[model samples]
Target: MNPEDLQKLVTMTMPYGKHQGRLLADLPGNYLNWFAREGFPNGELGKLLALMHEIDHNGLSDLLKPLRGRGR
Candidate 1:
C-alpha cells in the first residue's frame, strides 16, 4: 500500500497477543488468517495486519524481504 505501512511491517513489533514482540511481517500465515477470519484489530495495527495477511495469503511475502533487514 504505502511506504510507511510496509516499513512498519519490518520495524514494528506486535504490541500484544500470542505473537507479541514478533515482527508483523514475520507473523505466521495461519495467525494472519485467523485475524482475517475473526476480524483484525482496529486502527493502524489492524490495517498492517490486514496488509500482511494479503501479502502472506497471495504468496507475495518475498516482496517484504528487501525491506526486512533495512529496519534492523
Candidate 2:
C-alpha cells in the first residue's frame, strides 16, 4: 500500500454503512472481516477497506495510532 493510504486510513471516515462517519482505522475487525467474507465495494473506498481489513486481521491496528494523532 502507498504511504498516503496508511495516512488515509487514520484520517478518512467511512462514507456510508452502519459504521458511517467512523474512522477506517477504528472499524471493528468483525466489520472488516465481514467485508472479507462477503466483498468490498468498488473504487478507492473498497481498496482502503481491504487494506484496513488486512491491518485489523494481522493485529497491526496499533500501527495507525501515530497517524491518528497526526490528524488531530
Report the C-alpha lDDT of model 2 over 1-72, residue by residue, as the tens digit: 998999999889999889999999989989999999999999999999999999988888888887776845
TM-score of predicted model 2? 0.93
- Taking all chains together, each candidate's TM-score versus the true structure is 0.94, 0.93
| Candidate 1: residue 38 Cα off by (Å) | 0.5
Off by over 4 Å in 1: none
Off by over 4 Å in 2: none
Q: Residue 33 deviation, candidate 1, in Å?
A: 0.4
lDDT scores for all predictions?
A: 0.93, 0.91
lDDT of 1 by residue, 1-72 (tens): 899899999999999999899999999999999999999999999999999999999999998888877856
Candidate 2's displacement at residue 72, Å, is 5.8
Q: Please give the lDDT score at residue 56 for candidate 1.
A: 93
